[model samples]
Target: MAAVVHRLAGPALLAHRDGIRAVYAAAFAEPPWHAEPAEADGYLTRLAGDVQRPGFAGAVALDGERVLGFATAWTSSTPLPGTRSYPRVTAALGAERAAAWLCGGTEVDELAVSPAAHGRGLGRTLLEAVTRDAPDARCWLLTSVRADATVRFYERLGWRQVTHPAPDGYGTAVFLGPGHPARAAAVLPSL
Candidate 1:
C-alpha cells in the first residue's frame, strides 16, 4: 500500500503533533539515534516553536491513520541561529560556505522513517515534499555518520556529504543538496 504524503504547516502540524511524535519515536528508537521516548516527547515541545519559524514546512507520510514517516524544514539565514547543532554545522562547513550554501536556504531539520517503512520510499518522498519549493532547491541536512544506512539513503537521493570534518560533539555528517555551490569540490566518501 502506498503512503500518502501530506504537506502540513502551522496549526495543521500542531494538531498532528501526537501522530508525528509516534512516528518520530518509532523511527529514532532503533540503532544510531536510539532516542528515548522522553526525547521524542521533548521534540513535541520544540515543534511548537519550530512551526512558527520563517518558511517552516513539514510533510507527513501516512498509511491511513498511522504515521509512516515525516520531514521538516525551515529557512535559515546568517548567524545560523544558535540551536541544536547549527553552530557545529557552521564550524564544520566554515562560516563562509555555511553562509553561502546554507544561510538563506532551506534546512531539513528532521527526516525519519519508521523502521517498518524503510525501503518503501517514504523517507525520500517526505524529504522531497518538504523541500520541493526551496529557492534554487537549496536544501541541506545533517545525520549521524554512524547511521550508515541513513547516510546512504540521502546520498542515493543525490545529497552530497560535505567534505569538512564532522565537528566534535556533533557526531553528524553534513550534506548539501544537488546544485549547491559548495558541492562542486566536495568529496563523496561512503560513511
Candidate 2:
C-alpha cells in the first residue's frame, strides 16, 4: 500500500502521538540516542507541543494506519533543546552549546523514518513542509556523527556540518539551511 503523507493539523496532532512514538522508537535505536523505551511518550508529547506552537510544524507519512515516518521542526529564538544523556552526551556539543544553534533560525527538532518505510521521499516531504512555510528559516539540525546514512541523507538535502566533533564522543552535523551552498563541500564522513 502507498503511504499517504499528511499534515497533522488542529487536534489531530495529538491523535497521532502514539504512532509518532512508535516511529521514533524504531528510528532512534542506534548510537548516541539509544533511548529507553519509557521515554518515548515524553518525546511524542514534546513533538505535540511543537505542532501546536505558532511557528512550529510537522509532517508524517502513514502506511495505511501506521505512521511510517515523520519530521518535526520549530522556529525559535532559541537553538535546539539539549538532550539529557548519561555520562553527558559529549563535551563538544553539550546542551548549552546545542541550544546556541537555535538562535536566529528554525531548528529541525527531529526527523525519522521507520526502517520498513525507507526509500520513499517521505523525509524530504516532511522537511519541505516545515521549510516551505518559513522562507526565512535559517535551516539547522544536529545529528550524531556516527549515523553515516543519516549524515549522507541530510547532506543530500542541503544541511551542513557546523560542529567539529559530535558532543557524544561522536561527530555531529550542524546544517546551515536547506539548500545552503556549504553543503556542496565534500561531506566529512564519520571517523
Candidate 3:
C-alpha cells in the first residue's frame, strides 16, 4: 500500500508515538548509527521535550496505521547550541556562516525510514514533507560522513554539502537544502 505523509505540529507526534519509536528502533539499528535500544528510550524522552521547542514541526509516513518513517525539525538560533552534534556542526561551518545560513532556518533533527520501506522513496517523501514549510527553503541537516550512502542520498535530493565531512571521513557534514540562499557558494566538498 502507498503511504500517506502528514505534517504534524508539536505534541501531535505523540499520537503515533509507539509507531515512531518502532521505526527509529529499526532504521537506526545498523551502520553508522548502530543505536542501542536504550537510545530509543532516550529519544522518546527527547521527543516529549522537542515538541515544545519554538517552530517545532514533524512528519510521519503511515502505511495504514503503521509508521513507515518520520522526520522532525525546528528553527535554529544564533550562537548555536552546545548539545549533541551542534558544536561540531558550528565549528565546521564557522560562527559567521552558521549564524547567517543556519540560524532561524529549519534544522532537521531527525529523519528515519524503516529498512522495510527503503526502496519506496518514503525517505525523500518524509524529508520534503517536513521541510516544505522552511522559511525561504532555508533548511539544513547534518549527518556523519561515515554514513557514505546517507551523504549521497541527501546530495541526490539536491541538498548541498556546506562543510567538509572530514579527512578520515569521521566528522559530520552539514547540508544546505536545495533552495537555500547560500547553496551556490557551498559547492566545494573539501575543507
Candidate 4:
C-alpha cells in the first residue's frame, strides 16, 4: 500500500479526523482492547482538546486520502494527571519514578492502525513519526498487559518495560522509549 506517514503539530491530523476515527474504531475493535465504536468518536473529541496540551505532536499514515494509521503524543504533565490510566500508571511505577520518567517527557497516548492495514508496519511507522521529536528520545507509553501482541510489539521495537503490574493490581504496563535515559538503567521486570 505505499502509505506515507506524516508527522505534524496537530492540525494536520485533525484535518483527517473522520479517517482517523475510522481507523481507531477498526483497530481497537479486536482482541483485548474491544473498544466500542462509539469510543472512537469520544477519542476524537478528546483529541481536539489534547492537541492544546504542551508539546503536543501527532502523525498520520495515509495511502492516498485514506488513513491507514495514526499516533498522538504530548509532554507528560509535571503534577501527573489523575485521569484515564494515569492513576494506575502512578500506582504501578510509584510517584518518584513516574514523575522522573514521564513528567515533561513525551507521552505516547495513542497508536492505531486499521485491521485491514495490519502487517504493513504502519503502527511502527506512525509511532516513530509521532515520537521522533521527543526530547532526548525520552518517550513513554502505557498499554494493557493482557494484550500480549501489543506488549511484544513494543518490546521488539526495543522499548523497555519499566513497570510490572502488581499481582492483584491493574493489567497495565509502562514502557520507556528504546533510547530513553532511564530505559538503560531500568531494573524492572522482564517481559
Number of the predicted model whose lDDT against the real structure is largest = 4
RMSD of 2: 4.5
Ordering by TM-score: 4, 3, 1, 2
Clash pairs for candidate 1? none
- Which 10 consecutive positions of candidate 2 have the poorest summed lDDT? 81-90
Compute the lDDT of residue 27 as modeled in candidate 4: 86
How does model 3 fare in lDDT? 0.87
lDDT score, candidate 4, position 71: 93
In the range 12-114, model 1's lDDT, one tens digit per residue, is 8677788889888988898888899999999989889989999999888888877888889999867788877888887877888778888888999998788
TM-score of decoy 2: 0.75
RMSD to the true structure for each prediction, in A, is 1.9, 4.5, 1.9, 1.6
Give the lDDT ranking, best first: 4, 3, 1, 2
Candidate 3 C-alpha error for residue 118, in Å: 0.8
Any idea what lDDT model 4 has? 0.88
Alpha-carbon shift of residue 44 in model 3 (angstroms) = 0.8
TM-score against truth, every candidate: 0.92, 0.75, 0.94, 0.94
Full-model lDDT for every candidate: 0.84, 0.67, 0.87, 0.88
In candidate 4, what are the lDDT values of residues 4-89, reduced to their tens digit? 99998788789999999999999899878888999999999999999999999999999999999999999999978788788877
Winner by TM-score between candidate 3 and candidate 2 = 3
lDDT value for candidate 2? Answer: 0.67
Number of clashing residue pairs, candidate 4: 0
Model 2 CA lDDT for position 32: 61
